[model samples]
Target chain A: MESSRYANPYQTGFLLGLLLVATIYVTGRGLGASGVFKSVVTTTVEAVAPEHAANQPFYQAVVSKHPGASPLKAWLVFEAIGLVIGAFISGLVSHRLTFKTECPPHVPTKVRWIAALFGGACFGIGAMLARGCTSGAALSGMAVLSVGGITTMIAIFGSAYLVAYPFRRLWIGGKQS
Target chain B: MMGPFVPDIITDQLNLIVGFLTGLGFGFLLEQAGFSSSRKLTGLFYGTDFTVLRVFFTAGITAVFGVIILTSLGLLDRNVIYVNPTFLYPAIVGGAIMGVGFVVGGFCPGTAFCGSAIGKIDAMFFVLGGLLGVFLFAEVFPSISDFYRSGAYGDLTLDQWLHINPGLIALGFTVIAVAAFIITARIEKSVNPDAPVYSFPTKSHAAFAVAAIALGVVVSVIPDRQTRLLERATSVAYQQQHPVERIDPQDLALRILDRDNDIQLIDVRPDAKPGDRLPDALTIAVEDMFGKGWEHELAATKKKIFYADDTKPAIEAATLARILGYRNIAVLDGGLSKFKAEVLEVPAPDHPLSFEEQMVYDFRLASAEKIKKLIAEGGKKVVKKRKIKKVQGGCGL
Candidate 1:
């Protein structure tokens, strides 16, 4: 299959920026991702253990905040669904769709999977604590010049660079390879 | 019409559709920018690739300038726009954790979804792990609730916190972003000499950077609509050139006594003591005249009588209302102080009065007593202030 090249970063970034401005102008909000995962978790908990969900303060808070609808029926959930669809379409167009585990040459697939899982778990908890993920808190927050958003953006990038050395083996192969 | 039409023009169902469309665009952009690849994403940290920085900073700068321009043009209400609230400690700690997650997981939440969509097996695991993380957080939320809620500064903007103009901040960010782009390009070249450089500065790229900085400068120099209009309204030349029609205190008292509905009394005073205001008058400060609440009152056909302790504020507000395209706005002559002396405290005639003067004196004396009684009676009626509607936004849980 002939794979098409990715669009230029600056061009795509400008388009993304315009989209964000339009979203803010029209809906008065920015894009998000992890919130959908939260919704999914909350809904699953509610469905699987109704009594437990009802009894817990966290669950109760979530339920009370979004009264009258199933937790699955949220704006971020719909957006996430759309995001998946869009990505799928992009992948199809680029001939990049393949079921594969991507990792450095030296890293074992099992190790990559474990690291991915651990990272994802950290992101989920971190997003919950920060009130948003990269797209929500950092990118969207920066557009509006929110202090929290910029701070998070700095911390994310800064901390990543700090930890990059220890985690170098996970991404880069040895010089011999 | 001004934007942020949710709950006003756009309904909840339509808003969901908007969210979907925006997300679609967002996902498509991420994929097109090669953000769907974890290797490319992690390259930012390793300095092998700067695609993430290029796109992230460009998009952020674009949106920032876009917002500034829209607000300056009065096309978007900045007040109603959602600014993510700051929780200082939590943001720092959470962001640091997410950073570690970025290195370990290779994809943030948005990119994970994109990768998962394109049939990436590791991204699928990441999603599952994310759900597990959220579940764990929920289970342990009872103990960490206080920490989660701590250090909250509600919807604070960088400009407000820094005590600077928003345009200046936007300009500073633009400069910083451009510098980062240049420096990171050099870093990427040094880190991976054999790798293809996508962000090598071209003629168009340089031109675009210059244009963006120029735009930043323009926005910084040009004041927002409110400030411009307020300045114009307060200027002596503007006030002299565009004089507001003045209504006498006695005439206003007569209108009130007659219970005339054609006249609308507007108190433009920023500070008014309780029970000191005129009957049936709406208190809209000079600054608040541009708000959505006074749209109907200002635009209505009724004669708007603006009053303050002195005439300047009343005249300024009336002038502002006129400039904003409202009609039939008039300032009270000598303001409420004149009204008090002329209508509420009429002195008796000492000498033999002419027929016309006698009639005027009799009317003033009788009207003074009636108006005083009316003020005392009307003081009991509480005027309801209009509530400005805030647009609801945030990452929904």
Candidate 2:
């Protein structure tokens, strides 16, 4: 049996805040995650059609600047790698390392998996447009009191709550599948 | 001075050392908070758990206060700190899209890493989907790049744009955050009483609020770095209007003639030589002055007189020094040649000088001749240049 225990929310948040202070103080930048999505995609494109990857408008602007650097050689990429390792260790220690889909009783496994994929794809693309994802834009921005951070936070949550009502059945539903 | 000794003190490997360590802390804390569980994260949308709101707000305000306090204490220079730049249209449009993704996918990028680590197949698909979306974005970027880069507002903060005290703004945040924490907690309890109600050890929300207000007061008292947060163009404009104070040639000559006990002349010329400098003048290349923190040696100085071979180098180097937060950077008018003619004597030359070294010798030799002429003329004159001035922006988020 997996014993589910987590730190109190406020305490965890307090500690997380200290960590953010240390991060910004030391690195002069905040934690980021979605940049890895762009890195991976660039790596794949570069592998298949190097010319196309280099010639793409986005690629020409960014990837070409760092002449000899590998696509994967990014701070966000490395930090993300460490993050997965850290998370895995936590799950393993807590005895929560099970391969399963987490969903409401009425949501079928197929629907959950599909939703995760489709939703993830949207996040991947949207993160780029905003110049960051939730971690980079919302959380980190709030720490430093950046306007972009504040605005993005409002938009993300406000839009989510706006749509949560119409999609109620997808989450809280009638019967177990 | 106390800490945040990042690129300043430690420059060689900033990201590798600090990035992984900070990331480890971030990942560990997130997992311990149960963000590894998709259901727990999705609970933010449902009223079953408002932990995300509580945690997010608390964390954000804490950092804001922490930075302010550290800065007030002189531990960190806030100017060197990174503020994510603001772009209007994309931030809103992209954020809304991400919100939709959040409701549908149950995890954002950082959480997805943890989710996948916990062996969730759905998390893995989410990662794959993210890759596909980013790839698709890159492919279609030629058309969308305009929209993506549109409405470029430079790095902005409430305090900077509104000209309000950061401390006051921070306290306002405290009021809102405390209210949010209380309200969200109530919403959670009413929505699901069975959800774990946390009782933090020792400290209460009221105490935190008081602490926040106190910190805000402290922040408001510290004098701001004027124009420090402005966009590059604006900052440069401010700098232009407020050029570093200068000491004229005649006034400087009178001071040197008296040999004022406190006057310290520094030569920052790249090719300066032994014969080309005044007595007791320090030799420090412009790069070394800023990069090695040698400029900090003059931190307590009342006046710092620096000189280069030409007015251009002197002006450029001094301007850079000013930008790096040095003070009283007065250039020696017309450098060594002026000093030689104003105060020193000429020596008779036996041979003609042509090589770079020879030219320097000739110039020094010629300076003595000019001094005799100046003595005969009995006056000092100033040099002036025609000015052509102009204007800049950047962002990650």
Most DockQ-accurate candidate: 1
What are the lDDT figures for the candidates, one per model?
Answer: 0.86, 0.71
Per-prediction TM-score to the true structure, in the order listed: 0.92, 0.74
User: Every prediction's TM-score for the first chain?
Assistant: 0.96, 0.94
Model 2 bad stretches (over 4 Å): A175-177, B2-14, B198-203, B225-397
DockQ of each: 0.77, 0.57
Deviation in Å, model 1, residue A19 alpha carbon: 1.5
Tell me the docking grade of candidate 2. Answer: medium
Q: Please list all clashing residue pairs in model 1, or write none if there are none.
A: none
- lDDT (Cα, tens digit) per residue for candidate 2, span B36-91: 76777778898877777877877888888887776655455565566767888888
Candidate with best TM-score = 1
User: What is the model-wide C-alpha lDDT for candidate 1?
Assistant: 0.86
Model 2 C-alpha lDDT per residue in residues A89-149, reported as the tens digit of each score:
7787888788888887888888888888887888888888887888888888877777877
